[model samples]
Target: MKISEELKYTSEHEWAKIDGKAATVGITDYAQDQLGDVVFVELPEVGQMLKQKDEFGVVESVKSVSSLYAPLSGKVTAVNEKLKDNPSIINKDPYGEGWIIKLELPGLEEATHLLSADQYLKALGL
Candidate 1:
């Protein structure tokens, strides 16, 4: 399980890397590991609005299908279109090339509610 010190984490297992008012979001390494060999990703369109904790997409793996949650209230600025053709990239590099979406954050302060890498590790009993 890889946890990025630079990113914020949610209990539901999403990670967010904030850059000013925009954030890149993805399922964590732990999440993909649990899902087991991702085969498809169903993501929202660019320009869609998402509330914090909303089910923004779904990830389907050989083991199961799981909902992908929003980490903050924002408009989606971009989606990882590459995943449509090669969803297994999420299993290969979840924090890098496998990032799911970029969101235009309306309240950067809401990020304060997110867990740090240490906190997220503790939450998982790691």
Candidate 2:
């Protein structure tokens, strides 16, 4: 499992990469590995306002379907269009090209409450 130190993680297995007041959110590498191969992704439309920890999307895998939660409240600026056609990219590069959405965060401090890479690893009993 690979967790970059620059990102914050939620107990729900979501990651948020902070950039100024904007944040890019996605499922972590550990999450995708556990979920198996992805087949479909249902994402929120651009301009949708979401609350912290809200269910904003869904990821469907060959084994099961899982909810993708938001780590912080914000208005979605964009959704990854590539996933609509190739959901497997999530399993290939979850933290990079596979990122789900970019949001203009409502509260920057919300990210401070999230876990660090080491904390996430410990939470998983790694």
Maximum-TM-score candidate: 1
Whole-model lDDT, candidate 1? 0.96
**Span of 10 residues, lowest total lDDT, candidate 2:** 105-114
Q: lDDT (CA) for every model shown?
A: 0.96, 0.94
Off by over 4 Å in 1: none
| Lowest-sum lDDT 10-residue window in model 1 | 1-10
TM-score of 2: 0.98
Highest lDDT scorer: 1
**Per-residue lDDT over 57-115 for candidate 2, one digit per residue giving the tens place of the 0 to 100 score:** 99999999999899999999999999999999999999999999999987778888999
TM-score of each: 0.98, 0.98
Note the residue pairs that clash in candidate 1. Answer: none
